[model samples]
Target: MIKTIGFGIGLVRFANAACTSGDGLEGVCRTRRECARIGGTGSGRCVNGIAVCCVVQKYCGDVTTSNSTYFANPNFPNLYNGGTICTFTIRKLSDDICQARIDFIAFTLAQPDANGLCATDGLTITGGASTVPTICGDNAGQHIYVDFNGNSTIQLNIFTGIAANSRVWNFKVSQIGCDCPTRAPSGCLMYYTTLMGTVRSFNYGTTGNAAMTRQLANQNYGVCIAMQPGYCSINWAQTAGDLYSFTVTGDSPTAVTTGTAGTNAVIGALCTTDFVVIPNPTFTGATPGAANVDRFCGNAFQPLTTNSKPFVLTVVNDANEVGDIGNRGFSLDFTQQRCNNVPVIG
Candidate 1:
């Protein structure tokens, strides 16, 4: 799925030749003087090692159309205390570009309300194919894939209303060409490419105060994992000692289970509202009917192995939180296993 590359904002100003920076960020080929004029940092070389690889970065109130651009809150690296809205607009570098990938290198904002709503502070995306939930709290290292679907521009707005907490955010926005191999499949809000990685719910991090409810409500999206070649199965395990992980509550008297056998394993219809769908879950050392458990909720996730092709994990959360359940959400570790290939002899 290779697509022709396109240049980003002010394509006429920067050289058309693509290059990479020393820190491995994507950039455009520009002379040192041109790079300096645009406030880009120059590293590495392009155009037969003669032109500089100029990495462009934008801040709040800036509009960018460049590929592989970095945008951050004003006075980034330092906390932003202003209680206001900061926005960055992204225009397609070219018509061939069909998606935007936003990586949150560092994100911290005022916490959501008790009901898991981003009422106080949040990050919102406007004009993309997918509905990105308004997110707040600590989401550093999280990333999102947005589909352009012919929209000419996209906007990222960070809203800070309360003044107490110091806010900071740094993000890298990369435009994805249509049919790009790295582009996420349509409808996957979050995508993973590595053979092994951790998938945490948005704002899945430490809560400084007890009043905060870590789980965000009304979240329903697919978290897709790119199936690495030669790998046929993926194993999911709960992060050890992370108590808040997998705290999606169920109806009372159903009682959350710890992956134990018998009626203890909550699966399928047993998980009514909030549950993670792990298709065709296979429990290691399982008892009767234990392997049948697919949808999991009620506070714990056991080690699960599955051979589901295309590797998609669906997270479904309803609108409201159960009373005093303290639903903190999930943190899961996944590793794809290689398939065994046997030699055929004549």
Candidate 2:
């Protein structure tokens, strides 16, 4: 896969002098002055400045190789008479691990005149469809397509009113590739746990305690929780002595249950009485099945107590399989406070 080798940073400052050559424009717009403002080093530099000119060249590579050129001026109705150049590099860390499968490269730009308004446009790679401009509500950006199949070079361009000084662009390169194995799996149901308060003791049925239970629940893609145990009990603080008030979070169709704490069980230990939830197990893919649990514990939720809480669960496949075979395993740890209220569980 394409890993970042390095990035080139360049800066340009606007010229101090005002534009003198005005063909018909009204404002104090000067091609020379504007060019200087873009931090051009010499005369005859493009109007937007050298940075744009240079990036375009770098992205396009040799002019003889690609039919593209930078826009001569910002005032033309034909904004992009000749193509502009954009360039960047990607490095491959391993020869056999993965290869770059980049779909496209996105470029975000700042608004014109700082009224907080922005716009976006996209350029095609090979023979893809052109993307429409998205109004970024005072902050717009653009995306340019690139072919990263075997090459790491990116080339494309856009036209805009963004001044070089006030202009800002961000690049995001996306790819789907395999990762090399970094370690061997542990035999125990690989407990990928995240705790909030503290792991003090392993008692069950106490005030301010939490626990997690799993059952043979069947979900659309996988299975849902068959039964949630501690939920009903948690609400009892508001409705004193009401057994009906006890609610488990939700039930799984396949019905997963908790086993007693031991070597094979998924257990939770608390350092204090303030409830602490054990981290939810992660899977490697969208669906949970025999293959999903192959690398981790499958038969039990070990540490069940009033102090264990289950937040979010995710599954990720192995790092080296083709298609979706490598996509098994719960790779995400969603116990952090910020991930608690997501609408989807996967």
Best by TM-score: 1
How does model 2 fare in lDDT? 0.23
Least accurate 10 contiguous residues by lDDT in model 2: 214-223
Every model: Cα RMSD to truth: 5.8, 20.9
- Any runs in candidate 2 off by more than 4 Å, and if so which? 1-85, 89-108, 111-159, 162-165, 170-177, 181-346
lDDT of each: 0.77, 0.23
lDDT of 1 at 51: 70
Look at candidate 1 and tell me the lDDT of residue 48: 59
Which candidate has the highest lDDT of all?
A: 1
lDDT of 2 at 246: 17
> Model 2: per-residue lDDT, tens digit, 20-129?
22232111222443334433323223334431221111132322111121212233232222234333334333333232222112222332111111222222233112
TM-score of each: 0.83, 0.20
Instruction: Please give, for residues 6-53, the per-residue lDDT of candidate 1 as tens digits.
Output: 346422333456777998777888777767876788889876555789
